[model samples]
Each structure stands twice: as structure tokens, then as C-alpha cells.
Target chain A: MSLRPYLTAFGLQWKIGLRYRIAVVAGLVAQMWFGAVTLMAYASVYHAAPDVQAPLSLRQAMTYTWIQQSLFTLLPLGCLPAIGDAARTGAIVYDLLRPVDMWNWWLSASLARLLGNAVPRAVLLACVAGPLAILVGLGAWSLAGPASLISAALALLSITLGALLSATIVMWWNILTARTLSPLGSYAVGTPLAVLLSGMLLPLPLYPDWVRPFLLAQPFAGITDIPIRIYLGTFIPGGVATGLGLQIFWLTALTLLGRLWMRQTVNRLEVQGA
Target chain B: MTQSPSHTLSGPGLYRRMAGASIVAQLRYPGTFVIQAIGNFVTTLLSFFGIWSLFHRFGSIAGWDIGTVAVLYGLVNVAFAVAETLGRGFEVFGGEYVRTGSFDRLLLRPRSTLLLLLGHELRLRPIGRFLQGLFVLVAGLWLAPHVQWSAVLVLPWAIAGGAAMFLGVLIGQAALCFITVEGLEVVNVLTYGGVEAGQYPLTMFGRWLRRFITFVLPLAAVCYYPTLFSLAHPDPLGMPTWIGALSPAAGFAFLGVMILAWNRAVAGYVSSGS
Candidate 1:
């Protein structure tokens, strides 16, 4: 199939996602506020237990909170809003009848939407939380950069993969919306799952020893936790290679399974007449 | 086709009858209803698990144990859940009512607009969050070593105040829709963000943040102070114990102010329209 249709889908979605400049700014402020609160909580916790050998230092944890908060909108928190609307109005049947590869079409749109929402806010927030805060005499509390040049480079690469993995997961949610013919199910299932498992709620390293590995291995962790860990130059057990490998593994695995699921869902989609 | 004005119901009576109708409509789709409720339960449960795991790793955070924090967590969740259940109409008013001009239909009714809105608010889906929160509250109370008969008596009052405060936030959000339909997403910072902040002890936040939530939003008044009062825990910041019991009044006062603001906003909208 020619790539033009998929590219058109991507461009359209990218523009729609960027149209909400006000939302980006507002979301930035909200995320910043929550990030600061989480940082202060971590500061108090770490200070109170100075004797304990925590996995991530206070500064690392603070930085983690900053990055996570800045990228809060990046996660696939629910089905595509467009798809949800389509489902509600019975317009989704047209989506399936389109003359293009369904998976690639939705995948391109999903990725564009995620990046479009996340990129501007991430850049704006990093400036305010990192350099601006330091210049304004809040240096100690400002978000720190990568541990080194190498870490920064690797983190950049890992984060790209992480974004792809996140978009792929959103495809599953999209298909779920198609099957249920309701967007609410995807959101009801998506929000808390992503928030908890992605280490947005708490740093996965902070969990108990028994649960740490499970948290680390989850697909959602690959979305942000691993990339953030790489940026912090924290140990990733096997190495940076292993961390990158885990992300690629999940990406490919999810894409294969998701495509199959999408095929089955589309085959069975039955729109009811009013 | 003469309408009988004498048949009009009182505010509470109208609310009960309309709310009962909404519940029956929701119950018509049992499968969707159960899925939503279960999904709600699981999502909130995951966040609780995040907290539980953190406490498991470190015995206490800043002298606040899992049980102590759980009291704050449960109280906030329970209150927020109640608000979410009963204020669902106001919560979606901007998108559903104002944007579509269906709010005019509400204004044409013989009943008070507030009662009509309240009648639309009694959603059953939030029963999931309520049940989960109750489980945690009971566990927290059981594990907390302190015992006071007054604590039991104070719980319901605090929950009521917290619920009202959150409902006020939702109402304020709806009122803002009359001014600007876009960028209202920032209000999530108050509703969802407040719950996150309230889950932890007040002292864990910075001085300014603590002041904001106390004086500006008064979430700490409805959630934190009342929690401390019931737990019989000394405020780490050294406020008198009686303040905890009395502080819930701040929440109710805040709600009254929001209602006044909402009325002013409605008047503005009416004047600006045909």
C-alpha cells in the first residue's frame, strides 16, 4: 500500500493535537505543581530515612519526578478521543471501511497525537523546571540533566522507542473501543493502569524488593521508567543494552499481538441501527 | 394541554425522583454498568497498591506510617468518590450542557437549576471507588493504635464536608464554561490533583503549597485536619488538636462561595446571549 494515506492521517492528527495551545500551557502548569508536590514528598521521605540505602538518591528521585511530570500527557491514558467520538456517533464503521492498512493508519495517528501533545509541554517544562528554576535561585530544587553526555544520548534513543511502545499500546485501547462501541471502557481501564505501572504514581525503584523486578519488566515501565533510569545513569541490572532491548522486545511483541487483535475486532464489528 | 403548576415537586423531592430515573436508565445496560464499576475499582486499587508498595519498602515516610497515610488516602478517596458520584452532571456540564446549549432547557424548567443538576448527578459507577476507599479506611482504623469514641463520631461530618468542597470545585469548573469553553482542563488540577495532594500528610509539601491547599482550596481543612483529629495524631506543624475537628467548616464555606460565583457566572451568560 502507498504510504500517502497513512502520512495524511498522521499530519491531520498532528495538527489537531497541536491546535490546543492553551491546553498545553494549562497542562504544563498543573504538571509542574504536581511535580513539585511529589518532589517535596520525596525530599521529606528521603531526609527522614537518611540511614536507609535507597536505590535512587534524593536528587535522582526529584529529577525522575520532574521528567515524569513533564511527560505526563505522553502516556496512552485512554483510547484516541477521535475514535471514542466516532464510536459514540456510529461513525467508526467508516474507519474500518477505509481503503488502507488499518494498523499503520491508526498507529501513525496515535504516535502523532502522543508526540504532538507531549513534545511542546516537555520542552517548555524542562526549560522552566531546569534552567529557569536554577537561574531564579531554586537551583537545589531544579530538575537536573542527564548524568553524562553518553547517558543523554542513550536516553534520547531509549525515549524514542518508549514513545513507539506507548503508541502501540494505545492501538490496543483503540481496538477495545471499537469492540465495545464505547470510549468509556478504554478510559476506565487505561488511566489507572498506566498511572500505576508507568511509575507515574511512584518510582518503581521505590517499591519493595519482591515487586521491583515485576514493575521493571512491565510494558508500561518501558514507556518512561526505563528511559528516566537511563537518564539518571542508574543501574539497569544487566546494562543499558538490556534496558533498550526490553523496550524493543515489548514494542515488537505488542505490535504483533495488537495487529492480530485488530483484525479479529474489525471482522466482528457490528454497528446497531437506531 | 394546560400544565399544572401545583404538581411541581420541592427541590429535594424533584432531585430524588429525577436521580432515581437516571439510575434506572444506567441500570438498563447491566453489562456496561458492571464493567465500568469493576474498572473503577481496579483503577483506584492500583493507586492504593502503589502506596502500599512504597510503605512496604520503607517502614515509614517522614514519621508517617502506612496506616497513618492510609487514613488520609481513604478519607480523600471516599470524599472525592462521593463528589464524583453526586456531581457527575456539573463535572460534564461544560462539554455536554453549555457547548450544546442544552443548559437553556435546564433553565426553562420550573425547578431550581441546582436541583435539576443535582438530580442528574447520582451516578452509580463511583460505587467502586467508594467501596475500595471504605476497605482501606477500615484497615487504617484497625491498624491505627489510637482509640477515641469522638473519632468515630467525626468521620461522617468530615466526609460530608470534603464531598461538598469537591462538588464546589466541579461547579466552579462548570461556571467557568460560561466565560471560556476552552482551556478548562486546568480545573483537573484542583479536582484530581487535590486528591493526590491530600493522600499524603500536609507537612510533606512545601510551606507555600501547604498554605495554598489550606487557605486557597481548603482541601487540607476538609481532608487532612479532620484525618489528624480522628487519628489523634499530633500535627507535625504543631497546630492545636481542636483545629482538626473544626476545620471541616472551611470546606462548607468554600462551597457557599463557589455557589455565589456560579450564580454570578450564570447571570453573565444570560446577559451575553439573545
Candidate 2:
């Protein structure tokens, strides 16, 4: 299999993702606002009930939020916008005609797009929210360092796997877009499902005891929650290995299931002329 | 300026007709609408679950119980969903209209651009969020420890105000597009970010942040004061409860100011020579 075509697809998306420098800044500001509001709410809640043994300390939760906000773009919010535009205008016919493996082409593009958007924003936000914040007398609210050097290295590996898992989830959405010939459904489903299940709204560790395990078991958990715990060295039910294992597991399972789905969608697209 | 061919229909009347057309177009694919609506419902519900789980552990946050917080959550979500549905055009105006140079075409239309934009689509998807919010609201009312008939009277007022305030934010964002289409996402900070903040009592925020929402954005006027008044909860910040009944008017005031700004932006428009 020639990897050249896939590399080209990846590069195309990576450029498109990086082109919007101003949007990145604007999105960062919006995310920072959300993080600040959420942190304040957490502080109030934690203060109101000093006696409760919460799953995460106030500092841990605040750090969790800072990281989550910085990496907001990394989550699978929707299908590729190009796919959506194509589906809307019937330009998807060109995509169908491409002489390459459809799954790899779209998957590589999806991964590149997520990374291009996420990487810069995360770096800029972390710098501002971590060290700079402390220098500016907001140390109590700054993003803390990883629990240890080993944890930092492990978090690095886990986030890479997490990114792969997110891109795979996006592939499912792309297939859904191709199936329906509209992008709206993918977004309507994707945005909410990812935000909730990925712990963007609240850390998974914070959910009620009865539901905590189920949240951990879900595919979305692999995207962020598990990796965050590994960095913080917070308790995962079976510790860090389970977290890494879940990421690899979901990446493999979703890729297999998603590839099958993609093939089915392609067949249907052929049968129903664009 | 070209005269609207159908002058018999005022700007608002045209909006009604256009909105009705959009509703029909959307309903053409009822299945898609249903799925998106359900997705929106689930997304908000999941966030509420996050809140519920927190309360389960702590019993209350900032001296407020689940029922009161539910009202706040429901109010903000319901308001945002309504504003988003009506302001869909403004929300995407930068990318769709300005970048494509379509704003020039919009200007030549006989009808008011604002009305035309409002008519772009009365999105049904937010109905999912709307229903979920209403459900939580009713549940909150039932679950609350103290209730007077005043809630029924005040609920409509607060929703209208909150929606209007959010619509103001959207209009301001669209106006900002006139100068730079590149950095529009910052507006989401005041819109979506506002909803997140409004879900909690305003006192939960730090003093500076608290004042910004109150004096600048007026979110507290629409959401916090109203919730406090309805729940008979005292303002830990020492604000008067009577303000809730009247403060929603600030939403209308904010909208009016944004409308003036939109007019200026339209007047200053230099077509994106695309």
C-alpha cells in the first residue's frame, strides 16, 4: 500500500487546521473563560462542604479542568468539515472516485486536523495557565505539574494514543456523514456525546460512585479522562496500566468496527449515485 | 437600496414567512431533525447528570441544594437553546456570509439584514435542549423545598430576558465580523461560557468575575437574580432579591444596544471582494 497518498491527505488537513491563527486565539479565550467559570464553581462547592471526601481534591479538579480546556479542540466534535461540505453539495462524488484506501485517507486527514488544531492551542494555553499564571499571582489556580517525571512521560504516550482514539471516533462520524449525506446529524450527536463522556464537562472521577465505573468503561473515556488521571497520578480503578490498556483497546476495536462500517457506507454510496 | 418585492409583509412578517419556510425545509427530513434533537437533549442532560452527581456527594453547593441549582441550570440552558435557535444565522455569519462575500448580496435585499438573518433558519434542533431544560425546570420546581405561585409568574420573564441577552451577544459577534472574521470564537465565551456560569449561583465566582457577568454581560441579572428571587435564596453578595423581577429588562437593553451596533457595522461594510 502506497503511504504517499495518505501523507498528502494528512498534510492537506494539517495546513487547513493551522491556517486559522486568529480563530485559535479566540477559541483559547473562550475555553479559558469556561475553565475559569468551572473552577470557580468547583471552589465554591468544595468550600461549602469541607467535610466531604470528594474523589478529587479541589487542586486536582482545577488542574483537570485547565488541561481539559487547553485540549478542547482535540476531542471529536464533529466529522471533517470538508466531508460535511461535500455531503451537502454532492461533491462527495470526488471523494468516492479517489484511487486510495478510503479509510486510511480520511483517518489520516482526521488525525492531522485534530492535532493541528489542538497542538498549538494546548501549548499556548498551558504556558499561560501554568507558569505564567503563577508568576502573575494566580498560583492557586494555575495548572500543576505532572505528579512525577515518569508520570509525565507516560502521559505523553497516553495522549498520543488518545489522539489516535479520537481520530478513529471521528472516522465513525465521517462514515455517518457519508451515510446520511448531511453533516448535521454527526455534529448533533458527536458534540454532546464526546463532551459528556470524555469528561470535558466534569472529571469522570467526580461522577457518582454507582456510575463511575461505567463512565470509565466507555470508549470516550479513553480519549481524555484516563490520560488525565495518569498525569495527575490520581486513582484509576486498576491504576495507570488499565488506562493505557483501555486506550489501546478502544483504538483497536473502533478501528476494526469503523473500517467495516466504512466499507458498508462506501458500497451504499456507490449503489445510490451521488 | 432595492425595495423588498413583497412590501406588504413588514420586516418581521418576512421573517415569519422565511422562518416558516425554513421549518418546512427542515421537516422534509424529519428523521434527521429527530436525531439531532435527541442528541441535543442528551448532551445537556448529561451535563445535568454531572451536576447531580456532584450534589449527591456534597448534599449542596454554596449553601444551595440540588433543586435550586437545577432551576439555575434549566434557566440558562433553556435560554441559550432559544437564543441559538433564533440566532443561527448570526452565529455562522462570519464564515458563511462574510468569507463568501454573501453579505454584499444580503445588503441589496429590501428587508432588514437582521430580520433576514433571523429568518435564515428557526432551528428545530435546539428544541431538544429546550424540552430537556423545561423537564429539569418542572422537576426543580417540584423538588424545591419552598415554593410560592411566584415561580410560574417569573419563569417566563426570566427566560425571555436570558434569551434576549444571548441574542444580543450573537448580534454583537456578527457585528464584530465586519472588522475581522478571523477571531469570532471569542464571542462563545460570553454565549456558551455564560450558560456555564449562569448554571451556578453568581456568588460562586470570584469577585471580579462575578461583577463582569453582572455589570457587563447582565447574565446575572437574567439568571442569578431570577433564580434567587424564585427560590427565595439570599444573595451572599448582599444583592436585593427584588432586582430579579426587574433586572431581566437588562437583556432587552443589551439587545437594543447590539442592534445599534449591528446597524453601524452594516453601514461600514466593505464587501469581502471574494
Best by TM-score: 1
Question: Which candidate achieves the best lDDT against the true structure?
Answer: 2
- Highest DockQ scorer: 2
The list of candidate 1 runs beyond 4 A from truth reads: B1-5, B271-274
Model 1, residue pairs in steric clash = none
Segments in model 2 whose C-alpha atoms lie over 4 Å from true places: A89-99, A271-274, B1-7, B181-183
State how far residue A196 of model 2 sits from its true place (Å): 0.8
On a 0 to 100 scale, what is the lDDT of residue A129 in model 1?
A: 94
lDDT digits (tens) for residues A94-204 of candidate 2: 877899888898999999999999999999999999999999999999999999999999999999999999999999999898888888889988999899999998999
Kindly list the per-residue Cα lDDT of model 2 for residues B83-170, writing each as its tens digit.
9999999999988999889888888887889988999889988998899999998888888877657878788899999999999999
lDDT of 2 at A208: 85
Query: Could you estimate the TM-score for every candidate?
Result: 0.96, 0.94
Recovery fraction of native interface contacts for candidate 2 = 0.91
Q: Give per-model CA RMSD.
A: 2.0, 2.7
